[model samples]
Target chain A: DAGVTQSPTHLIKTRGQQVTLRCSPISGHKSVSWYQQVLGQGPQFIFQYYEKEERGRGNFPDRFSARQFPNYSSELNVNALLLGDSALYLCASSFPSSRASDTQYFGPGTRLTVL
Target chain B: AQTVTQSQPEMSVQEAETVTLSCTYDTSESNYYLFWYKQPPSRQMILVIRQEAYKQQNATENRFSVNFQKAAKSFSLKISDSQLGDTAMYFCAFMKQGSGGGADGLTFGKGTHLIIQP
Candidate 1:
């Protein structure tokens, strides 16, 4: 079984631009979450979707948004990007049955560089 | 809001030696979870170990183990017989137990950089 997978391994965008990052969860997973990791720092939670419904959201600004599809795939969108937005965006997936204490498996992550 | 803190920014251990990474978190919830994740240069976040606040016994996975102190709100990782592959950035994370089986995203620390000397 493949782990979570992400698209556009790396990206470069100018300030004020918008970008979308995609993620495909494991075959049997139903929960997908997004996190942002700045250089030399640990990842910060962004949003989580379970069964195609938004479950939780972090302290990120309104510019950041995400949605999950029927197949449990997810996309993270960032609008009006600022240089501070440059970071590694990670996607994680977990089984819905063990939602409370399930271990989350993470993707390789998409590196976004805003200039 | 819960917060995870890793005081040591960097640490090094010789091959076959043992090393421990400390983590402290602040939370008001009685039931929660703690995790240790390893991020190599490849940027893949790998689950190292986890502990449930309700359990008194610590969690051990192969060469990795955790020292979970509920009273102190501390969860530390100890790696025995360390190998060169153990060199990576390790993060400590927390999650509160929510009702309705809803999943809450993790709250992570700044991370500790571990170097295994061969």
Candidate 2:
């Protein structure tokens, strides 16, 4: 079966522009989370939504926001992008019923470049 | 807050040799879970091995295993007979147990780059 899937594998935007990345979770998965990974650093959590509700949020700025759909798909939106915002945006999903610490599977990630 | 740590920035090992990546984490709660994730050049994060806080026996998955010390909050991954395909950035992660936080996902370490020489 297919694992997680992400759209717009790569994107380029200028400062102050907005971008939205999408992700489709594995079949039957109900939880989705977003992370931002700057070059040379590990991913930092952004937002997490489960069953279409905000389950958790990271220490990110107001420019970052996300929403999960009823079908378990998710979207991560960044507003007023800055050059420092250029990074890989990763989407991960998991099933809460049968959970493991790392059972969360990740998509290939969206490579965002801001000028 | 839970925090995972990986001290080694990079490591190299012969194709047939073995290598161990160290990971330690800090958590106030006693019950939790630890994980080792591998991210290749493709940038898709994959689970390598996992350890439950309460389990006494260390976890093993074929050539992959973990040295889990619940008391010390230490969890290290060991890879035997490394292969070129195993080269990736290794991240140590932690998830607090039953935190009711739902989908916070995992707290990851800075990660270590593992290179397998062929």
Candidate 3:
């Protein structure tokens, strides 16, 4: 089965511009989450969606938002981007069960460079 | 709130040798999950191993194993017979037990860069 996939592997944007990154979860997965990884740092959570519902959000500003589709695909949007927003955006997918063994699989991530 | 700490920023070991990466976390919740993820140059975050807080036994996958100490809040990864392919950034993460099936996402450490010398 295909793993989590991300689109526009590379992106270039300017300060105050807006950008959108896409993700397609693995088949049969229903939960999708977004994370941002700065160079030399671990990923920081952004937003998570399950069944098209917003389940959780991180400390990101209002400029960051995300939504999940019925097919379990997701889109992460950043508005009025800042140079600080330049980083790799990652998407993860997993089952929505409470099982302790459940694991979240990640994508290759989209590299966004804010000029 | 929870925080994960990886004190070793980088480690290098000869192939076929054993190497251990250290991680410590602070959390008030008793029921949670801990994970070790590997990120190669490809930048894909790969799951290495995981352990549930409630379980006394540690978690192991093939050549990778973890020494999970709940009392010390220390979770260390041991790579036995390490290979060059093990060269990558290893991250330690924490998650609440009922984090809505991980909807709350993971609390990750800054990561340790592991290099296996040939």
Candidate 4:
């Protein structure tokens, strides 16, 4: 089975521009989460959606938002981007379960460079 | 709130040698999950290993193993028979157990960059 897939591997945006990153989860997966990784740093959680509803949200600002579709695909949107917003946006998908063993598989992140 | 810490920013190991990457976390919740993720140059975050807080026995996957100490809040990854493919950035992450099958997104550490010498 194919793993999580992301679109527009790399993007360049201006300070005030908006950008959208897409992610298609693995088949049979129902939860999708978004994370942002700065250079030399680990990824920071942004938003998590399960079954097209927001299940969890990180400490990111209002400029960042995400939604999941019925098919379990997701999109992360950043508005009024700042230079600080430049980083690798990652997408992870997992099965809906309470067990800790349910692993979240990640995608090749989309690198967003804001100038 | 939870925090994962990886003190060593970088480490190096010769081929076929064993290397251990250290990680310490702070969390108030008793039921949680810890994970070690590897990110290669391709920038894909791969799940290396995971340990549940409630489990006393450590978790291992092939050449990768984790020494999980719940009391010390230390979870270390030991890679045996290291290969050049092991060169990558390793991140320690934490997640709290939520109710109703919902998940608390991961809290990650400042990763450690591991290099394998040929």
Error of 4 at A85 (Å): 0.7
- Across A1-115, the per-residue lDDT of candidate 2 in tens digits comes to 8999999999999999999999999998888889999998889989888789888888999999989887989999999999999999999888876545336788999999999
Give the better candidate number (1 or 4) by DockQ: 4
Of candidates 2 and 1, the better by lDDT: 1
| Model 3 per-residue lDDT at A7 | 95
Among residues 3 or more apart in sequence or in different chains, the pairs in candidate 4 whose N, CA or C atoms overlap within 3 Å are none
Clashing pairs in 1: none
TM-score of each: 0.96, 0.96, 0.98, 0.97
Better candidate by DockQ, 3 or 4: 3
Query: In model 1 chain A, which range of ten residues has the least summed lDDT?
Result: A95-104
Q: Which of candidates 1 and 3 reaches a greater DockQ? A: 3
Best by TM-score: 3
Highest DockQ, which number? 3
Clashing pairs in 3: none
Q: Please tell me which model should have the higher TM-score, number 2 or number 4.
A: 4
Could you give me the TM-score of model 4 versus the true structure?
0.97
Task: Give the per-residue lDDT of model 1 (tens digit) for B1-118.
Answer: 8989999999998999999999999999998889999999999999999888899999999999999999999999999999999999999999886642335689899999999999
In CAPRI terms, model 4 is classed as medium
List-wise, what DockQ does each model earn? 0.63, 0.60, 0.76, 0.66
What are the per-residue Cα lDDT tens digits for candidate 2 across B1-118? 8888899999999998989999988888777778788999989999888777888999999999999888787888999989999999999988766532345668999999999988
Candidate 3 CAPRI-style tier: medium
lDDT of 3 by residue, A1-115 (tens): 9999999999999999999999999998889989999999999999989889999999999999888888999999999999999999999998867674357899999999999
